[model samples]
Target chain A: MDSMIQINNLKKTYSNGFNALKGININIEKGKFFGLLGPNGAGKTTTIGILTGLVNLTSGNVLIDGYDVIKDYKITRRMIGLSPQEINLDVFFTIKELLTFQGGYFGLSLSESKKRVEKLLYDLGLEDKVNAKARELSGGMKRRVQIAKALVHDPELIILDEPTAGVDIELRHLLWNSLKEMNIKQNKTLLLTTHYIEEAEALCDEVAIIDDGKIIAQGSPKELIKADGESYINITVNKINENILSDYNIDINENIIKITSKNPEKDIPNIINILSESNIAVRNLNVKTASLEDVFLKLTGKNIIDD
Target chain B: MINTPFLTLIYREVLRFIVLYKQTIMPGIISSGLYLVIFGHALGSRIGSINNIDYIHFIIPGLTMMAVINQSYANSSSSIMQAKYLKFIEDYLVAPVSGFELSMSFIIGAIFRGVINGILIILTCWMLTDFNVHNYSLSLFFLIITSCVFGAIGVIIGIISKSWDQVGVFGTFVFMPLSMLGGVFWSVDMLPKGWQFITILNPLYWMINGLRYSMIGISEIPIMFSIIISIIFAIIFTIIASVMFSRGYRIKS
Candidate 1:
């Protein structure tokens, strides 16, 4: 597949001498749902800003498709649609008007803009709020409007910066389904920056974990989670004792004991037999695979929401 | 198709203010009417006339220029500042529009508001007084040039401001005082010789004089000089604004 976005050693330093992005490189393939995970101040938005021409690069090159961002901004801008993390719509404008105006910004005529707006409003489940001012809509509806605004021009690549931040679960699922449909039916490339590790695990085919202004790890969610082939076993006994599993890295809390097992299938049975011999009845047990959250924690050593 | 982006941007800007006409357009008309009543009616009889025109008539040109200048500056400056604070400027920043096109759209939008205010004030003046517009074509020419200059100045102000208070400071301190002392209420010849020279140096004074000449065929300076100064100022401010945008000044970083 051809690369949709290519960043060659990108760097960005703010006026206050803070380096937001340090010698970074990334290439997003065409027609892929890519997730960029990072903690606060991890340069995710900074990279998005550069890609959308909202920030000047300190040094390096960014190519969208085959066009350099700085030299061919017109073409690059027309090729990408960004729904920024913040709610930046004109509050006075109605939902339909905002989408129509945004389409016109991309050089669409009024008739063309209206046709696209109608479909976007209907697709995003905002047809009822079409005439309502943006400020009058609920938080979830406003987010849906932002997404509709981004997709109004029908750009080839869509970059969403935390599109689900502060959104309710029911609305989030709706947004996810819409995005999935777009990615599948339209073959559109999407770059999603989200703090919800579970969301990334559920939707992203590939993920990149960025920390301290650098991308520390990048791989498919499952590949990154189980690349070490590590799993864990949790056992519940009728009673808990400290020295019961001293030969392993065991964590005991009350009547439960957790152990890291290289092979859960083989380890669970042997561990159960030992517990049976010790006069402690094994009440329940289960094997748990490493999740994307664990991988993110292992790489960054901090929670995604923490600074 | 060639003018789609440019025209759309201008349309959006124009619609922005038009939708908020209660806040944008009404205030200028009401305020100009008050000035016509207080300054043109209450004080016109006492101040007598200048250049063989009634004091009420003489002040109409000045008041009309004031409306044009203030509205032109306020329209662009407030529009940009609002977009910046609301973070909606990212819409254009990420779009396919060029910096020049963006700047021109705002300038033209300001001109629209400025011209509207000027015309409304003139209509109001005609209702109360018998002030005749001496040269219709020249009056339009100077009105457009003045609006362009002030609108360009507004863009520069909008780019430099980090907060709305800064915009207010420019209006209250810089623009307000300049309009008052720019020979709006008095003639330049009334001042001492040295003071008259200093007064002529003010661009706002040239704008008012140019407008007065267009409306009444009497000016403290040559009409050509006023035209040249207004055009040159507009060009210089436009160039500065375009460069500031291209550099991504405060709006980007």
Candidate 2:
């Protein structure tokens, strides 16, 4: 599949001599939920700002559907919609007005903008709040309005920057489900920058882990988990003792004792005894699957949130 | 397609001012009313007449236009500047609207509010002092266009302001003194020769003079000069505003 957005050595430097994006390159596939997964200030938003034309690029090129961002801004922006990280919708305008205005900004005719607003409100589950002023809506409702406004142009590629930053668990699930269906049923390409790892893992088809103005890793969620072939067996015995668990080919790595094993079921019994007899103080332990968090930790030697 | 985008932005800007009527329009009317009641009644009696018209009658057009320009410019300029300071312009920044379209919306919004305030002030003047507008056409023309001109200036102010406090500085320090000294309470013909030359330099001085001429059949400067200055300043202010907008000045960073 052709990339929806292609970055060729894109770089961005701020006025005060801060290099926000340093020689970055990314290829995002069409109709895929791609995550620009990184912590705040890790160049995710800066990269996005450059792509959306809110922040100018210092050097290099960004192509959306083969059109350079600066050279062909009109067309590139026409095909893209962005819901910024901040919830900054106009407080006075109604939900319908917000969506209608968003459609208008894309040069859509009044009748067409009206129809698009209706469709967006319905799809985003904001049909009830159509006439409600933005300030009157609940936080979740307002968030949905912001997203609805973004989708008013019927953009094929949608970029949501930390879309769930201040939302709750239930509301987040609702939003994720809506986004999931949009990508699946409409074949919309989504670029989601989120701090929520588990949410990204569930929604994103592929993830690019960026740190310190660079992409450290990029791949499908499953591929990333499998590519990390080794699994650590974290065992907590009935008793407390790190030296005893080491006899069963186990290597203790700070905090908890660990052993590299293909199958933990076979290794758990032998490791459980040393803790039970020696009373090493068994607190809690479980063999969890290697996730994107572990991948980030392995690559950067620090948690994704930290970097 | 181009016009649709333009209309969309203007419609939103119009809706913003009207929807926040208490915040944008009412304050202007109330402030202008206080000026009429306090100054028109008190000073009109003491100062008597200027060029055969009551002081209350002579100052009406200037006061009305001043209020119109003040509110119209403030509404648009502060609305956008606050949006910028709050970092909300990012919504429009990420949208597909062109710079010209965005600038048009803001300028038009200011014009709308200014015209509305101008009408209210004229109506109030008629009610308060029985000052019948002698040339209705000129009054309407001067009222509408002057508001548009100053409104454009407001957009430039919005684009240039880095903080909300800067907005206050412009209003309190610059616009306030210019309007008060621009002859909202007096006439330029009454000033000394040298000060009269300085008054001719103030764009609002001509704007108020034009509106004043329309209302009372009297003008310190010729009506044609006033109209020419109003049009010239409107164009200049618009070019300045649209240029700042097109460049994305302080906003795109």
What class would a CAPRI assessor give candidate 2's docking?
A: medium
Q: What would the per-residue lDDT of candidate 1 be over residues A160-254, giving only the tens digit for each residue?
A: 99999999999999899988888889999999999998889887888888888899888898788766436788888998777877777788888
List the DockQ of the predictions in order. Answer: 0.75, 0.53
Pick the lDDT winner.
1
Query: How close is candidate 2 at the interface, in terms of C-alpha RMSD after superposing the true interface residues?
Result: 1.7
TM-score of each: 0.94, 0.87
lDDT of 1: 0.87
Per-residue lDDT tens digits for candidate 1, residues B45-120, read 8989887888888888898898899889998998889889889989978888778888888999999988888888
- Point out the worst 10-residue segment of candidate 1 chain B by lDDT: B1-10
Clashing pairs in 2: A238-A276, A239-A275, A239-A276, A239-A279, A239-A280, A239-A281, A240-A279, A240-A280, A240-A281, A241-A280
**Candidate 1 ranges with C-alpha deviation above 4 Å:** A228-230, A237-257, A262-282
Instruction: Provide the lDDT at A209 for model 2.
Output: 83
